[model samples]
Target: MTLKAYRTHFYKELEAFYPQEEYETFFKVLAQEYLKLAAYEIPLNFQLELDEAQRNLFDKALSRLQQNEPLQYIVASTEFYGFPFQLSPAVLIPRPETEELVDWIYTDFKNTSCTILDIGTGSGAIAVSLAKLLPEAKVTAIDVSEDALKIAEANASSNAVNVQFIKQDILDCQALDRSYDVIVSNPPYVRDLEKVEIKANVLNYEPHLALFVEDQNALIFYKKIAELAIQALQPNGILYFEINQYLSVETVGLLKNIGFSQVELRDDFAGKPRMIKAQH
Candidate 1:
């Protein structure tokens, strides 16, 4: 079939599942990812015919899109901190706010060769980005799921950045056996009560273990990581978190209460307070 026909049908099938602009964007991405056709190239190749293999791949992706499966997962890749990362259901697709968090860290220590630890490092987006940007920095990342650690390992290798990947539950772990000059976590902070505010694409497709916590104790991961950092952080070390926008006050308060000096909450580009930094 002609490329135009495929595009038409792809939109028709997902029209109800996404907005008009979104469905169009999805088609453009599909064309680029599966056929190597740029968005503008789609017009130049409007009458181009799809061979059996290309058609089969596009058909399967279209079917998955109709079910509301995230296109990133269907493609099995995503970009973080301006770099491509392989992804799986075991990891949360990296987000722009998280990129902002990474930016803050990279900017702060861009010239230093500090030991950095990323707690609950799912896809290793932050850790691997740091390693690449600061080749001198020692980076270590941890995750509870072996599946996530596998993806993280792949990302580190593909990014050509060396990062130590460890499997351990932060809530249960006692010691990292060494101190870090930088400790960061973008751990589970979404509360059960806030589910309604989340998009269906995230709620349905992303791993809940990495996305949420109990409503009564939404800060569980942050608190536990902070307590551990208090003991594990080298003197004057920095602790950073990608926090829930609504819980910025509580997150800052927790860090301050832990005696982290110069605790600061920063807003994302959208002006939401989505990141915080504290010095131990």
Candidate 2:
């Protein structure tokens, strides 16, 4: 098939299941991945061989796409903080807000030899990115799931950075017998009640353990991480969070109640108050 023909067919099929905007972009992304997988042969750009083997691969990708699986998850990799990261169902796909969180932290401590811990460090994006940017700093990442840690390790290797990866649930994290100069997280803050607002791509494909909190206590992870920082941080150590768009005030309040001073909240590219920074 020609590239034009393939484009039309892919867009039509994708639009049958997803929004027009998403379908259009995903179709282009699909073609790009297919081309890359095929080694980008000049004449065969975006056109599968149509033989059994190529057909099978194409069918599998299309099936997952139709099922609303995120393309990043299907490919098992994503880009964050200008670095490529390996991913899996074990890890939450990186988001732009998380990138912004990393950038803010990187800039805030660019000249310091600080110890940093990224709690709930899915895919190790935040930890590895920080390690790469601040090679002199000590960066440690913690997650409850071993499977997620495996992917995070792979990502750290791919990024060519060293990070301490620990397997521990945030709620039950043991004392590491040390204090950090900065603690950061983009923990699960989405409440079950907000499921209606989540797109099918996210609700169906992303790991819920990294995305959700109980409606009765949507701030659970934020509270727990804040409490930990109160003791785990060195005096004047910083705590940062990428929070739910609707919970800016509540997140700031939680930080203040934990005795974090100079608490500041900032907006994302969309102007939603999505990040909070506080000092212990």
Candidate 3:
């Protein structure tokens, strides 16, 4: 069938389940990433015939989308920090709040050579990006899940940056062994009760191990990581976290109670205070 005809069919099929723009954009991304053709260019080649393999691929993507799979996982790729990353069900896809957290670090320490560590570094998004931006800095990332570590390691290599990957559960570890100039974590902060607020795609497909915590113990990772940071961080070392939007004040308080001076909470582009930066 022609490209135009296929586009019409694919969009109409998914528009019932998703918004019009969402499905339409999916077609455009499929064309651009898989076909090397832009959405605008599709009309120019409206009469171009799709090969059997290409048609089958489009059908499969549409089928998966209908099943509520995330488009990023369907495409198996995403862009973050101006670079491409591979995604799977094993890792949570990087979000804009985390992007802002990374940029905040770059803004402050772009030129200085320092030791940096990423806790719960699923997919190595933060660690690899920092290593790329601050090439002179020492970068290390850790995850409790070995599967996550493998993906994180691959991402570091694919992004053409070097990072040390280790499998360590922060909740059980008392010390990080060495000091760090800066430590950042985007650990499991979502409360179990907040699952209702999450979208269907994420609740159904993303790894719960990387997204959730017991509501009563929601700040467990932050508290534990902060304690470790107090010991692991060098004098004047900073601790950063991408925290839950609902608990910004409480998170700041925890850091302050733990004796983290210069504690500051910042909002994401959406204006919710979701990122925290503290110092030892």
lDDT of each: 0.91, 0.84, 0.91
Clashing pairs in 2: none
lDDT by residue for model 2 over 223-255, one digit each (tens)? 888888888888778999999989899888888
Q: How far off is residue 169 in model 3, in Å?
A: 1.0
Q: What is the C-alpha RMSD of each candidate to the true structure, in Å?
A: 1.3, 2.4, 1.2
Q: Candidate 1's error at 18, in angstroms?
A: 1.4
Better of 1 and 2 by lDDT: 1
TM-score of each model, paired residue for residue:
0.96, 0.91, 0.97
Q: Residue 106 lDDT in model 1?
A: 91
Model 2 Cα shift for residue 70 (angstroms): 0.9
Prediction 2 TM-score vs. true: 0.91
Q: Which portions of model 3 miss their true places by more than 4 Å? A: 38-41
Instruction: State the weakest 10-residue window (summed lDDT) of model 1.
Output: 34-43
Per-residue lDDT tens digits for candidate 1, residues 1-280, read 9999988888888888889998898888888898897778888998989999999998898888888889999999989888989999999999999998999999999889899999999999999999998999999999999999999999999989899998999999877769999999999999999999998889999999999999889899988898889899998898999999999999899888977878889999999999999886
Q: Candidate 1 has what TM-score? A: 0.96
Alpha-carbon lDDT of model 1 = 0.91
lDDT of 3 by residue, 156-217 (tens): 88998989999998899978889999999999999999999999999999999999999889
